[model samples]
Target: MTASNPASVVPSIHDRFAVVRERIRSTCVAAGRDLASVILTAVSKTQPDEALEAALATGQRVFGENRVQEAQAHWADRRAAFPDLELRLIGPLQTNKAVEAVQLFDVIETLDREKLAAALAAAMQKTGRRPRILVQVNTGAEPQKAGVLPDDADALIASARDGHGLTVEGLMCIPPADEAPEPHFKLLAEIAARNGLSVLSMGMSGDYEAAISCGATHVRVGSALFGERISPLKPS
Candidate 1:
């Protein structure tokens, strides 16, 4: 499809949201759970502003972005028009960018290491932002991934809570693409329960249903909502 084509040919944001919401509803129903308990975070990294406008018009208040720079550029101004919007940083964070991340996001879902934890704590002290945080656990133990290993998650969470004075609200994870995600989701849920944390930010578009069934409280959905991201949009 070409850009010149009428917008009618493109799936309306309402249509996409309805489809995804229905899927979430069905999944929750199947699990004997309340739908309101789940938070549907539209992953908006690399998505164009027009697409974001469409989603905002459809009342999508929660969104996830994969990069600090991109999110700062894309949302800095647009947020003025949607004061109630909530943005979550869902990507791996660098120690150097902790202050910016603390300022730019309402939640940070990729808290994975001590260095990063310390940086974020210092940043929070400097900025007084203190966005809610989640410890990303590398449940699959993939060397290339950016989460704390499963064995280390408990200690990291404790440090973030007791040492750094950061609010470790929950746990997040990205299971290996080739593996069944239920086990990982289940593990995250267990970890959260043991630590008295309430949020379980697991699941993507492909495995969200299973994640929900296994007790995911937040699902980061991108492609299913906005379609595959086009080439990066110039930050507006």
Candidate 2:
């Protein structure tokens, strides 16, 4: 199907989804990894409802969102319709939103600090919902980012696992935008390996193939599937 511009045909969500699936399949084959080992997490943040519907129609059940409120708005009602939907919080999570986040998401992929971990542990206990957790590591150590520094990740992971009784499934990272992503992916993989974490949530639309090769178990893809976001929501 084409958009208003006759000169350019816009691929439907199904087409885009198929293309991405093919890419994942081929990348897995090339990496000598099982196709089922890696998951394609469709990033639905900032997308219109119609786009989300289209992706759901295409059988995409795993989605990643950036904000707790936005995610609640997007999936709260639809949960009844799509009971199997797996929601992941891929952005920085605030301690205050822990209860809401614990109730809504199936996986929390941004556990960075001890305070947040404590909040999540409390939230999980209060809500009686234990979503899987992944520690976000600031591999580049960029000051503006929201992840545990490489030097401190082990401590945080241990605390989350032992102290808080939260499940530290794996690690997640967003490499510095200007730098090559493979190094960051490698570092994340190394950390996961040393920490005995099997799930690596370390890729986006731009570098998922490389992430798979570097042992990513979950890849968060957005623009490449939903088209460029037109109106990004301000960070909450």
Candidate 3:
């Protein structure tokens, strides 16, 4: 689906959503996976409130954010009005903001290290809201990335599940941008299988089809839904 102008008046959110849903449907059909099994997490990071409202108008309740503060600012008051909105934190989380993260997000997808895990556990206890976690795996072993190294996934998942009393439901990954992501996606699926994990939050706007074929349960897409982001928010 072609994206409308970001500079000009934006296209209807329902139109964009239809395009994305069609893509997802085609991908699922090609992969021989049930359409009901895959989830489309509209990556709404850096998008304005109007975009969110348009999405809501189209019956899109699930959204992904890259920053806690931005999401909190945007959705704090709106959540009450739209009670079913599901906010998934698809960005790296700072340990210091664990409490705020727990308060703001429904699913925390970037739990990669022990320090963050401990902080989140405490925050969940204080808030009495246990957000489902997906341990991020640095499948490419990129030093600059925010996920745990592939080798360390097992131990961290175990720690988050057993020691920290957190519900570690699955694994997430962002493959190296320049390389083919199929291997990395397959590796994550294998890791999740070994750990008895179900959710695989991999893929983005560019490679979601490949990810679904590799068993990605959730695909985070932005540009395909909202056009190119207006601002390049730094990775949090």
Candidate 4:
């Protein structure tokens, strides 16, 4: 009946972060883009505090979280210690949590429907905090996914910008796991370009290099940076 140490089971967060950064650097170079152009947003969801501390020690400031409550638990207190931390809500956000999301997150990357947009608009006005917004596009049109379908993206973007007075800064997408990601990436980039949006948040640990080549301004990498997430319920 011995407890196991997570450190021994997973790769050092420092080493993993360095490897991801180096890959980003090499990918950017090969794509003929400045390394600074692509933001390495370490997807920190489900990672423990120790992992976060290690990531912060490496000067990794941007993080993406999938849940509001989890993000609050992970970073609410750490905000003072890491003032430069930029938190992006990379999951489906419920309308009821708009206020908290607006107050906590630096960027909300899953703006899909008009009701959520209206909620966020009111929340922003109430809290006096305007988080950057990215309309998530469900390029694969998956029913289970949270993003707006590709055909409906422009209307939503326009509504977020014009109807709600929110500054929709960019587009985010998660391509179907089974399909090739480049086409989805290209579609997202095209949507951004036509809308005059500059930021394209696509790619994950597996296909970030291809995403860089497709003009992704931000890549949300998790396992590559923090090692595979270990489930809390799993036996040690």
Across residues 1-236, which tens digit of lDDT does each residue of candidate 2 receive?
Answer: 43323223234677889999999999999999999999999999987777888889888999999999999999999999998999999999989999999999999999999999999999999999999999999999999999999999999999999999999999999999999999999999998999999999988999999999999999999988987877756799
Candidate with maximal TM-score: 4
C-alpha lDDT of candidate 2 relative to the true structure: 0.92
The alpha-carbon RMSD values of the candidates against the true structure, listed in the order shown, are: 2.6, 3.1, 3.4, 2.4
lDDT of 4 by residue, 69-162 (tens): 9999999999999889999999999999999999999999999999999999999999999999999999999999989999999999999999
**Order the candidates by TM-score, highest first — what do you get?**
4, 1, 2, 3
Stretches off by above 4 angstroms in model 1 are: 1-11, 231-236
User: Per-model C-alpha lDDT, please?
Assistant: 0.90, 0.92, 0.90, 0.92
Over 4 Å off in model 4, which ranges? 1-11, 234-236
Assess every candidate by TM-score.
Answer: 0.94, 0.94, 0.93, 0.95
In model 2, residue pairs whose N, Cα or C atoms come closer than 3 Å (at least 3 residues apart or on different chains), thus clashing, are: none
**Residue 174, candidate 1: C-alpha displacement in angstroms:** 0.4
Superposed model 2: Cα runs more than 4 Å off: 1-11, 232-236
Per-residue CA lDDT of model 3 for 126-201, tens digit only, reads 9999999999999999989999998889999999999999999999999999999999999999999999999999
Per-residue error (Å), model 2, residue 138 = 0.2
